[model samples]
Target: MKLMLKYLKRYPKLILLNILGIFSFVAVQLGIPTVMAWMIDNGIGNSDIAYIKKMGGIMLIVCVLGGAGTILLTYASSRISTNMIRDIRNDVFIQSQNFSHTEYNKFGVSSMITRTTNDAFQLMLFSNMLFRTALLAPVMIFISVFMTIKTSVSLSLVIGGSFPFIVAGVIIIAKLTNPLSKKQQKGMDQLNRISRENLTGVRVIRAFRKSEYESERFAETNDNYASNSKKLFKIMSFTQPAFFFLLHLAMMAVFWISSLMIDKGTLQVGQLVAFLEYQFHAMFSIMLFSMVFVMYPRAQVSANRIQELLDEEPLVKTPTNGITAENKGVVEFDHVTFQYPDGELPVIKDVSFTANKGETVAFIGSTGSGKSTLINLIPRFYDVTSGSIKIDGVDTQNYDLKALRQKIGFIPQKAFLFKGTIEDNLRFGNPNATPEEINHAIEVAQAKEFIENKPKKLQEYISEGAKNVSGGQKQRISIARALVRKPEIYIFDDSFSALDYKTDATLRAALKKETKESIVFIVAQRISTIMNADKIIVLNEGEVVGMGTHKELLKSCNIYYEIADSQLTKEELER
Candidate 1:
């Protein structure tokens, strides 16, 4: 409720309107009973036709007013609930935008989606009930109980006697459903995760002939979700009938006891009729309150899930009033060390290097040697565990995150393209890039031939996940995207692994001229890819074992020599 009120308070006028509607509705409900009793005792008993007509007309007017009030209440509740949910979803999305890989791993992608969408929807349903029925229930109960006793204190005990049973049942239902609600939500998360994995990894599943295994995994999760839902629905289904049974018993007792009083000549027939009306309203109000109680556990569960997401503070936070750099060309790693949040050992340890303007520095190593991790530090994707990384002689942490990233163009090993035209994806790197800059980037990345072959060329639409293009095409487009940025530093994390050797050589030669004034870093496995680099750094188990040019490293660095020996011919190695 604390989380709910934070958003509910934004619309004060709607709250006031809802309140007005509740009062009007309650007034009509209570007043009609009194008017009926008056007609029975004074008009019908005395044969006064005019009084009957007058009272009938008044009841009609009150009913019309009550209908208007119900309409107003519904409108207010709907507007407030929908708007509140919209605002909450927006905040969840904005908060997620600031999350790093650490946070993403903390809450899986499927769980986050459930929180933003399903959990928020639960809150909306609860809020709508809160504004419509929850508010009116209390007011109705208080007034109805007062009128019931005023009509006959002895008869009111029937209603009062049934109250404790309803309260006890509501409490028991709440307790039973609380744990089940939690399990139900978790089951939903697992179901979504399996479905997401199956859809995204369909190709791998088919290639490995694991389609049956994948199907079984998904079916198991779906069954768990369905079982929890079935259990929850069973409990709720039992509640309504149980409450009605108690209501009927109370009504039977009221009728039996009131008949005895009427025979004793102490209770008039009209008063007896009025008493029953109040009893029904009071008992019905309790049922409404019980519904709110039963639904509270599920809504509270959803609320906690949503609040957990909003409460999470990202491990990497942007500093206020961050420093700005004068030049963005030079890059330096001063004894940087980094460990994963859950790892037992550091992935990159005490590594240091510097690349001046107009230098091409390459990194080569066996898999899992921190090649990608080292480059990720430059863009502050993960901050160093101990030492500071400086760009243009300024500590990376000191610079504003956006300002720091704007200085470098980074392309990952696995190329990814959004669903859009070729030009749209290219413009993502630099939104204001000119046609001339785009054409130059395509030529340098060696993407011109394939793109021009397409009927629409730049306007050609790329499907989701770039499924329409080949591996090499995606890599070139990714490279061209970075080239369009024309930043001071370019870091390609094995971005050329998809291309043939000839294309790789041609692209690198073109890059030498295009990026002569900028700092460049490349991580590759092939010896020929980095043999022409100005400097090459050899890594082993996250440590920099060798730092020198290809020829120099072949003499001093055993790790470099072995890697080059594996991929390079005797003639290429000597060259």
Candidate 2:
């Protein structure tokens, strides 16, 4: 909540103007009752029609001024609240962009989405109510109190007596709803997570014939969310009726008591009427204030959630004096070890290797053997717990992140593409790449034949997540996108898994010629995919158990022999 004030401070002049508008509105409201009292006492009582006419005209002018002030108040309040929301949403999104994988895991994708869109919207609603109703409530109450006191002290006491009861009711309702509001927000996050999973895994669910199970899973969260919302709204429903009942009860007492005072000649009829009018306005303001109390608790919950994300310091911070790579296409891992932030054991341990220009280094191991994790280190996705990874003889951490990444072309295991034309997606790697460069990359990646078959070629639209393309096609285009950069270091993280053996062989053969000046690092599960590499690193339980060529490893390393025996025929192995 305190953080939100930072954005509000940006528009000081608007706030000042809104304050002026509120003052004018309150003055006109309070003045109207007073003018009516004057008309009754001096004009009607003395039988002077001119005085009555003059007071009526003054009353009309006051009403007009009040209407104008309301309009100004609406405009200024709306402008400030909306602009503040826009700025806050932009900051939150930019902040999310800086988050590392560690932070992403902590918050999860669905929770971050909820905070960015839904939570920010909740704050906007609260701000709107604050400007239009919350501020006016207190000001109107104070002015009404002062005016009523001047009219008749006895009637003012009636209005004042009702204040404590209303305050207590509001306090009780706020306490009850606060916990429910927080629970509601958490429930909403869970529901969103379930919905996201359902959408992304819809095919998996249908393939497994688990549609009923998925439906039950969604229903459970939806029911919990609905129940929490119902409880919160039920508690809030008490606020309006309770406050109105207390206020009207006081109003009836004011009229009852004022009648006796008038009959006794102690108070005039005009003053009694004016006091009742002021009492109505005073109680009305408190009712408005109760509305604020009802809404503030929920907004406070959302504010805390958004603030949490903004306050998180990114684990990976860009250095102010970061250096660039002095030498190109050389990568080294010296006794590198890494563990996830929450993991009990390291994923890669005491592993060391190097791949220089014009060399192809491959890694192969069973699942959970740290193959992907080792390559992830060269790009500094996660910093090593011990030892160092260097590019061009300089420690990766010391190099500017953007400068370091520019030298490496990385393809993840799952190929993701944005919703755009083929040209648009390819240009993401090198925005300044020319058509000739693009065609060359497409040819080398073995994607030219398929791409040219399309009616639009490079201009063809790719759906979100590249769903319009086959798995093999997506993999090839991903490789071409990386090729457009012609980076000094190429990392293929099980990137050939989707390609048939023949296509995989062809792509790797063409890559050798195209990347003569680059260092290629490949992570593969298939023995055939990496058997021809210049050097192969075999990982076993987070440790490199073998390091050599295919023949060297087969003779010297038993683990390599068993892997080769399982995949190749006896005749092939003998050869």
Candidate 3:
């Protein structure tokens, strides 16, 4: 409710109109019975046809006004609810954009999707019910109760007797369903997670022949969600019939007592009919109020989930005022060390290096050697645990995040492309890039041959995940994307592993001329890929065990010599 009120307060005029509609509706509902009672006593009993007709005309006018009120109520409620949800969804998406890699790991992707779409939708449904009935029921009950007492105090007591039972029933049902609703929502999150995994990993499952195992895993989660839904439905189903049974008993009691009063001539037929109408209205209002109680638990659960997302504070904080000074493309890692949020030990420890403009530096290490983690720090994907990283003699932390990232073009190990045209994906690096720039990037990436052969050329549609292209082709396109940016620094993290040696050698030759004025860092497992690099830094575990050129390391470092010996023949090593 606190979450809902924050957004709902924006529409004060709609709330006022909704209140007016409720009053108009209540006037029509209670006024008709009074007019009918007067007609019975004066027109029917005295046989005056003109008076009866006059009262009927009044009844028609009251209903017409009430109908207009109903329309106003529907329109107001719809606008308020839809507008509130739109605002909420927009804020959730904006908040998610600010989250760092740490925050993304904290709350999984599937859960965030559920909160934004499913949880928000639940709140919208509840808001519609709240605006339409939650306020109207209380007003109707108060007015109907007053009218019943004025008609006859003795009969009003019977209606009053049912109040405690209705209130108690509502309280009991809410308590019973609150825990069940919580479990149901969690079940929904798990169900979404499994479904997403199945869709994205379909190829892996087929390749490993684990189709049956994956199906059984998904079925187990689906069945749990269905079971929770069934329990909620059963509880809701039982409530309505039980409440109606109680209503019938109250009605019987009212009719039996009213008959006695009329038989002794203390009450007239017209008054008896009017009293019954008031009694029905009062009881019906209670039923409507109880329905809100029944839905409250589920809405509360959804509201809490949405609130969690909005309340989250990202681990990475952007400064209010950040430095945007000009950089000369000098990257220095001074005794830098880093540990993951949940890690027991550091992944990159006591690492120190420097690379200036017009230099090509390479990192080669065994698996689990922190090559990717080391480069990720340069872009501030994760900050250093101990020392500072400086670009052009200023701490990377002090530089504006956007300005720092704009200076570098990073190509990840696993290539990923969105569902769009080949030209569209390339333009992501530089939205306003010219055709000449695009052609140059493609030629350097070794992607020009395949792209030109396609029927649509640059306009060809790249399927989701770039599944339409082979692994080597996908890597080339990803490399082309980075080249289009032409940033001051380039970081390629194992991006050439997918390519054959012939293509790898050619791409490097092209990059040598294109990136001569920019700092380049490459992380590779193959020694041949980095043999011609200006400098090579070798890592073992998290520490730098060797640092020098290809020949210098071959003579001085055993690790470098062993890696080279495994991949190169005696003739190649001698050369």
Best candidate, lDDT:
1
Ranking of candidates on lDDT, top first: 1, 3, 2
Worst 10 residues of 3 by lDDT: 314-323
**How well is each residue in 133-185 modelled by candidate 1, as lDDT tens digits?**
89999999999999999999999998889999999999999999999999999
Better of 1 and 3 by lDDT: 1
Question: Can you give the TM-score per candidate against the true fold?
Answer: 0.95, 0.95, 0.95
lDDT of 3 by residue, 300-402 (tens): 9999988888899876666668777666879999999999988899999999989999899999988999999999999888888999999999888888888
> In every candidate, how many clashes are there?
0, 0, 0
TM-score (C-alpha, index-matched) for candidate 3: 0.95
lDDT agreement of model 1 with the native = 0.92
Record all residue pairs in model 3 with backbone atoms less than 3 Å apart, i.e. clashing.
Answer: none
CA-RMSD of model 1: 2.0
Evaluate model 2: give its TM-score: 0.95
Model 2 clash pairs are none
Q: What is the overall TM-score of model 1 with all chains considered together?
A: 0.95
